[model samples]
Target chain A: MIRGLVRTAFFVAFCAVIGPAYAQGPLQLASDVFVEREIAKPDGTKAKLLEEPKTVVPGDQLVFVVRYKNVGTATASNFVVTNPMPRAVRFDGTADGAELVSVDGGKNWGALATLRIAQSNGGDRAATSADVTHLKWNFNQPLSAGAEGKLIFRGVVR
Target chain B: MDNIFAFRRNNRPARNHRLALGTSLSLLLLTVSAPAFAAGTVAGTDIQNIASATFDSPVGPVTIDSNTVVIKVDELLDVTVVTTDPGDVITNPGQTGNVQAFRITNTGNGDEAFSLVANTANGGDDFDPSLQQIIIDSNNNGVYDAGVDVVYVAGSNEPVVAPDQSKTIFVITSTPAGVANGNRANVSLLASAVTGTGTPGTSFAGQGQGGGDAVVGSTGADAQASSFLAVQSASVTLTKSATIADPFGGQRPVPGAIVTYRLVATVSGAGTLNNLAINDPIPAGSTYQAGSLTLQVAASPATTLTDAADADAGNFNGTRIAVSAGNVPAGETRTVTFRVVIQ
Candidate 1:
């Protein structure tokens, strides 16, 4: 009877230790959207700056940054980040060359040059950068504990 | 005052293959391609974005969504003006109520009102015309009507136009008196945004539609176009005089007196007169002498022409003498002389 009581206490201690971890998950994420601006520098040169888009208009270039961190104790494997394109903007390519873009709303994934969009007339045409509807980055290696990084892409307001 | 945008937390997993096909098909219907040179997204539109990350853990694969970020679009103020008339309007000296057509287009991304101004008496023209009234094409028929079209008063009926919409304006002016023919007159119409105009990127806070900020575009929110008025005055004048000689070499109006009648035709104005012909009917108490028609042009000697319609520019058809002077240049004179015996 004493051993049975000891087992119950041990099970209660395990539940208490693992309960918060399961609820909060192991990965933390944050996202930010900014508008790109060009300002003339003091020495007759121009510099590009990413500023909060308080007064964004159509045809303005935008930068989107997504940050992810592995907060759990163990390493995380097959880490993938996905971002859906907003309806009010058109994809203008990304500085990160490792991104896989989906022009058909994540149904098909490939480079922008290798995709085609289906037309209403039963014919398909090559997809341009503006036709991208989703962006993704897949890390083949496992993410170590407490590892953090950011991914960036650009778009133009439609 | 609300500069901070609240983010939304999305708890859905990433890369749901089962829903990808259906979601893409529906999204394709909403993906209408917008022109690259368009006025852009509507002002005050909220553009939201949310990203998700997935990874394999001891508790299996898990997905976590980042907070949504939003950006609100602002208003862009721009305008364009163009003259739609074919060419310069032709006018005569002291002409009034001439109409010049112009089109004003709002190329910005918000609904805006514009103030209209018409300026006459621009330099480099031969004369200055006076402004009569400014009319707007209220019916959008492109033609000006006295009662149907709206006469624009200074601040009273400014047109609130939508983006990419155009308003036709008619500037009425009166040509100045004593203006020379072939003279040119220039008139201009300027349309400026009622909100304001300045250098590009000038901002007006809380003045845009939906209480958003308004920024001036490349056109500076103001545009002007000019219309030309060309004076074309043309006419012809004629004078006739008679010299009477009696049978005894005395100048008297007697029954047997010979009357020499001379007709002077002068072409005036800045344009040539075509098909110019003068007709003089024989009086009731006179008899025309056969082969008595004489024709003279400018400073050359007079050449006697046959009174028949043969090989000459003169003909005596039945009762009157006709001279087909053809085309006479401006500021030129022609003379026709003939003799008659009084009854």
Candidate 2:
């Protein structure tokens, strides 16, 4: 119920007025961000724990998780997910190396090392992790009915 | 310099437009400019993220956007203090109102107040200077004025600074009496956030300006810097005495009496005296004796100089006797004696 309220609050006013259109859609998408905490145990060891971020600060690492599910009876094919980086966050990396990145607002997409940013002085520089503006993953296999999966990425607050 | 100019030129119009629109647009435009990672994202900033997914359905292609997620940035308390005075401040013994300049910067991403203190009793120095007052620069001029600058009071006038902004201040002190020349004293100034200070990552609930949590930064919300005061004094001391011998076999002032004058000169302190020459005028009622001028260095034999201005280091003109003793180092002394008969 709390998640439903937060989703309603996130939607635009026009979309909120015309609700239930996307609620009945075949594919449902949900996104959440978290901060990793290191918990120390009595055995003299530490474990990495993820929790809902409450007080985020600069230099703190964040985990972005996107869950997608197909609710319709029919199968979905050519699945592709795209996430734009926030202005105040620098892209770290994804859980897997299967994703492609765009440094120029999705104008071009390639492996991070193969990308270059064109400068106003008629020169170009190698694109760094900070230059990543968009992330995308393509799934070749078709999604069966009621199939669900999640994509994870990390970033640092600038 | 070129990059800064071009960056300002490219962003000024966008910045003005953002001012009319809102802060979210301004933040979006800020990403276009480079080299802004120093102060990081501002406190209370809402970092928003949204994801979209598309898949070909059995009928047609479809696209969907995930629910937006926002994480509000919290306040980070940090500070840095640095001395602005070039080298150590040169001072003298018993000097008062000596000032050591320092700059305090709020290196955090939120507005903060800082309380300042100066300590002079730090070790590894010859002596401790007495601390007087701490003054804040009231006019933003990087200088200290007695009445113009505001005196910093612990609670009443703690300095309030914005993110990445610095405040210049002065730590006033006085050197104690009997401090030897070339002696050094050090003074340190410490500035801490008025809200609180602790280890990094320590958080205080509801103490931040935006009603969020405040966390300590890498500096622990406190910083300190030291400035030095060095005493510099170079001086020379000279004393003269005269004795008379009468031609009538008595120590009396008489005609044809031989009057002998002795002058002792000494150099003291950390510096050397270059080309130190002493000249003594003859008495009004006396006449100088020929070849009577003598120059004697510490244990050296006395050497007489001629009356004429010749190749010797000493010379006697018609009215005075002059001795040229060059390069007198510290703790060294010289003596000159001459004879003049009473008229």
Candidate 3:
């Protein structure tokens, strides 16, 4: 009887310790990165994966919305994103549009200026870091454990 | 030994359960991570594939019509000659030392540059060797040579032939004294291009290189050079003389005897004659009897009659002689006679 009693107490203590750990659940870091086409208000509520626009004639104004959320335990800080400009599109500067960055597919992004000058010297206008046309919003304000933010880009479809 | 065996059996099941749980967790982590890596991956597609609209503006075709350029030669210009000697009269057989002048002119739409070559044969098909050769140098070099070239250089001062523009040229020929009565000769005027045929190159210097020269090669022959011929035949005819006798000799009042004069003129040539005018002026001393001045042949009208009552009477103006014969047909002759007497 005493052995049974002792075994029950040990099991209770094990449950007490392991239950909290198990109940804490997975450190789930999930986010729904959404891109919305800016149409008339009600229709534009539908968001999708970021995609290039079609039928971009010589003159057209376009807007893009990039929404990101952090539904995780830890804050997602110091995050950087890079995107490439389409060949058929020209970049209107950030005053009217978006801030953009480029990494050579994650190779040597720090010395981007020198790398860009070298790339321009190499006759590759598209390879320069300054050639990026993507919207980047550095969440200098951390994404506070389960927060959301958005980046907007207005472009002239040339 | 039993206690040890039982303990080992219990621990084996627990170890299997833990292994199963660990496997499930690993699978869940892999599934979630796999999507994260694939979230923003974009396929590289060409712009042409994603374009939704296209616009084009096509230009229409054009056509141009061809133009015609025609050059024609139209008139049988006259040649005139005068002699100061009384014995040198132009007549049929037995006539002596007469000089004849030919006046040729261009009555066509374009400039008629021609050369005169004499041949005795009636037709251009045959050449007579015994015929005296008269090689007239159009360039006036005073040398009788075969193939001596005469160039009709275009003059800036000369008028361009709009239509029916005329230019006259003359040739004078003398008949030798006591020659055969029926001697005759044919004079032919040959017309040819003075410059190279076909469309002339725009620039004399750069013909072979570019512009139109590359389109039409420099060595290609111009097709516009062509030749035409005109022939005129003149023959000396026998002169017939007859006296008009007064039937009644002795009369109280003898009016001046009236007489009639007749002259026949015939022309035969390679082409048709048009707008032909003949002028015969009476000798200064001869007087025309009243009511005797009249042309017998209406076709060959007398252009001038000094004795005509009206100033313009008997004048042949705008009269044409038509020859219905075939090419190089028999000669056409017409008579024009009027009366005159010595006062």
Identify the candidate with maximal DockQ.
2
Interface RMSD of each: 10.6, 11.1, 37.3
User: What fraction of correct interface contacts does each candidate retain?
Assistant: 0.61, 0.64, 0.01
Clashing pairs in 2: none
Model 2 alpha-carbon miss at residue A78, Å: 2.4
Alpha carbon lDDT of each predicted model = 0.80, 0.82, 0.30
Docking class of 2: acceptable
Q: Model 3 segments beyond 4 Å from truth?
A: A1-56, A94-100, A103-130, A133-137, B1-343
For all candidates, state DockQ relative to the true structure: 0.31, 0.39, 0.01
User: Which regions of candidate 2 deviate over 4 angstroms?
Assistant: A1-24, A38-46, B1-37, B139-141, B145-147, B235-259, B270-343
lDDT of 3 at B116: 38
What would the per-residue lDDT of candidate 1 be over residues B1-343, giving only the tens digit for each residue?
0121222133222211111112122234345443344677777665667776677878666655566666666788999999988999988779899999999999998888999999897889888899999999999999988889999998999988888889999999999888887899889999999998999889898787766788888999999999999997767899999999999899999999999999999988866778889889999899998889998887789889888899899989869999988888878888999999999
Report model 2's interface C-alpha RMSD after superposition on the true interface residues.
11.1
- Candidate 3 CAPRI level: incorrect
